[model samples]
Target: MSDANGGFRPRLRALDRRQGLAFMAALAERLRPNYLLYAEASEQGDPAALRVIHDLIWEALLVKEARIDFERQAEKLAEMEPPAEDESFGARRALEAVMALAACLDSLRGEAPEAALEVSELSRSGVQAFIELTEGEEDAQRLAALIRQHPLMDDEYDFQAAVLEAVEAPLDRGALKELRRLGRNGGVSNLGLTLD
Candidate 1:
């Protein structure tokens, strides 16, 4: 199950619907703090609103009887998108977080069959952007090389692989909770940011 050249999508497609949704939800959960941090700093967007949608995703996976209004959730998620004109790195990362969550919701609604892969790529892109911003390297080729070799990027790939492995196996409520815990990564984001 290599992630090379978007190879993981076919593997994701092999999973059952619930498994795929679980995979996306886990990645989205990991990304939640990125948006929350941005929202807090910018004093825009409702952090609690985003949290509600994330909570709903986990609940839906954990409880068989739980139901989510995907369309309404998508509408709510759209409102959280950062303005395109705000091109700060934080804004970009926050936007990716929102989009990843939206992809998760879309997958649940059967609108985005590749939601898991999209979330995976978004997470990696966020890490790459962070590395490029912090490294301060103007050379595109060197920066690209650095990003491929960075520890954060390695962790991102490893984390996604672990999540996929978890979902590929049999899952129950307890396993799902464990997966969420793994995604949480002890209150850390993919870029190693922690919510204060």
Candidate 2:
């Protein structure tokens, strides 16, 4: 089906199915920018962030589905034991982090926003490069060293401060007053808001 802009859209059913390994790999490369955009939007508190969030979730889930299909195919065709789960990949922790991010979004949208959002470094480029390096070399030890060197696992970024910083840059006198009004109406979060 084509959208109003005449772009051909994939059918819903087609999108719902598990993609092949090759297809998933291609899609991941294509959609990675969307993940980066999502991060930017999140930091900016852009209302469009929700749409990007949905795309990120869909893309990540499809990758997971492809992996499951590949595992099943390998077991059936090769008559070999299924590949062992690699805890070093930290897939579960990554999912948890995403879930936490979603929850933070919800909290921000609620009447009583949280005082602060604790977030880890969400460097999409770093993650993609790490995946490529690990997959290419098939070396978990090397991946661990990279992770340690890059400090990719650290939750050092502050979400609320980022959002405020992004939004404040373009605020004029009127917008600044409006922001102050809203800030007064809604108690500030423990997340420090610096007005320069």
Candidate 3:
């Protein structure tokens, strides 16, 4: 389902029993450890930790919901009959949407906020490139020409590898540490200067 702004709203009620069970399993897998820690923090009355855990749970839920949507769309597309000439473009558009959702879920897998944002940006550009690739293919001849011109279209390795490579890379803790150091050292202007 979509909201008034066209943003996705999870079709929680639309899910069948199997899909609902799968969603629940994935959600629990992602949140169980955090829930344990959240419980510990709550017992100690640590508001800050409690807040972080709450945010983590919310983020996980959003990611899981998106995964279900992507899977559902892909299944629906698979069950579709062969597209007529006019309907072909809709198939391509659906592919792009599924790609975007995959990118989002991939980004969120590790619970890394920055990586999720990066993957979202990269995925959007990837889909835009796909759109541009077919923009001038108004006929079979043009599409054939496009395929010949861009052989890499047959290969998805580059983008998929990039996304996974980036997700696997460790977060830069040094940057956060440097920011804290700067804060202690009296802000940006004093970053590299000696005050002796």
Candidate 4:
């Protein structure tokens, strides 16, 4: 379907339906930024102190959808620990962290409307990449590479893919487990915000 502007809309994939929670979690991680932006230059404060207020404004106005997604992931993971094979326990925890990043993004977005607009444009474009997955491996790889190149870091897709692959086929259990854990902390898990 096309939007009012005639831009092509994305249809959610079968994979998205089967792993909606995972998709949202991945998105939240993707839209959220890494490291706080400097609030202001200050000699009174340490030359280097982590301040995320700038990033907060970027998230709220820009990555609201992804933030909402991350919040859901975090909420869902609150109760369980060490999930069973089907439960994806490790992925759940990583989703929680994605929520944290979204929270920070929301805060940043409130402060800077212009920057927020730019970020939102990037996010909408990113979703188009998600839509491209239905085409084929070439499309998927292109999207994945685009995602990897994106300023926001989140490795959930890579992690989830590895897990899914292992679940679907025979893979090294140890390697699979490691990838699952790494997915949570990996570069892709930066929670949807640009490092810059």
Candidate 5:
């Protein structure tokens, strides 16, 4: 069962896919660790309503880390006026890190054996909206494009690698160092993407 957000978030409108992914990460942090996020469309029931009692211990650990990263982002963003623009290298890495963390939530989403969010679901529901309001086609396309711009070429590297690779100039080594520390130790690393 989706929240009261009118079922799947509207997909027709062009949304910032980066923002959507970030939001997904935040939502995943709120869920029980044992509980996955997406389910196959053929699933019999609501994956969201599963029992959180099974693994509160593990969930607590993941949640603690996620909360820390989330707080760090909030603090950093707060330092800037109106959140500034989104083209900064550090800023993009920060966003990608959030997206990486959010992927953890994606793993949980398709847990339901029968009710996953595969192509069939989208084909029927316009691939734009689903029973729950999250993301859709435009976001997916944007994500693909964004993925192509990764900082590091290798798959083994993570968010830190991406950020480090992208930021060629050492103009703000100190600030980058601090951010790198945060990225490496945060809940999720944006190694998949490079510094913008």
Candidate 6:
């Protein structure tokens, strides 16, 4: 279920640097499958590269001394964004995944303090777009209401809440690993896309 104000932005805003990075990493892990499917279909981007970036983010979270070249990683991630002209729903979802990862990288670089909040909004927007595309609802008012009640959207809201709750605690390697698994959501995305 969605909050009336949209999402847990306030809670995300309160997170410390490490907690914020953890939050972004988990949500990006959940959305990675969307990019994987798109890359497989279009043969344009490298899913492996994206996976490497995600792994780096997780490592930074779990290992205090983990060294990552955030600038280079961000450059690589920029290459993954689908062309703006590609208006297909899959492309949109793929872009969301890429952008979410970008936000994670930005957080790691200490560039965007609100990266977690940005990822939260991206996750919810991806769900809303999926609902719009699949349900074929044209009216703005109806679509807004439908998004609130839709199971997929509910899953998104619930998943974000869970991730936020999980990241609030002190995290170690094991805890971060568990958070990654939880974000995977049993291999399904907010858009219900599965990794092949």
The residue pairs found clashing in candidate 2 are none
Candidate 5 regions off by >4 Å? 1-84, 111-196
TM-score of 3: 0.23
**What is the per-residue lDDT of model 5 for residues 38-63, given as tens digits with 9 covering 90 to 100?**
11222222233332211221242234
lDDT string, candidate 2, 36-152, tens digits: 333343342222443344334334433444222323322232221112352333332223323333433332233213212222122333343544545474577876555445432
Q: What is the lDDT of residue 136 in candidate 5?
A: 32
lDDT of 4: 0.33
lDDT of 6 at 119: 86
lDDT for each candidate structure? 0.86, 0.31, 0.33, 0.33, 0.29, 0.85
Better of 5 and 6 by TM-score: 6
Ranking by TM-score: 6, 1, 2, 4, 3, 5
lDDT of 1 by residue, 1-196 (tens): 2458356677877887789889888888788788888898998778899989989988888887887788999998899888888998889989988988888788778788777777888898899989988999999999988988899998998888889889988889889989999988888999999987
Q: Stretches of candidate 1 above 4 Å error?
A: 1-9
Backbone clash count for every predicted candidate, in the order shown? 0, 0, 0, 24, 26, 0
The C-alpha RMSD in Å for every predicted model, in order, reads: 2.2, 20.4, 19.7, 16.7, 19.0, 2.1
Give stretches of model 3 more than 4 Å off: 1-58, 61-86, 99-156, 171-196
User: What is the TM-score of each predicted model, taking all chains together?
Assistant: 0.92, 0.24, 0.23, 0.24, 0.22, 0.93
User: Of the candidates numbered 4 and 6, which has the greater lDDT value?
Assistant: 6
Of 3 and 5, the candidate ahead on lDDT is 3
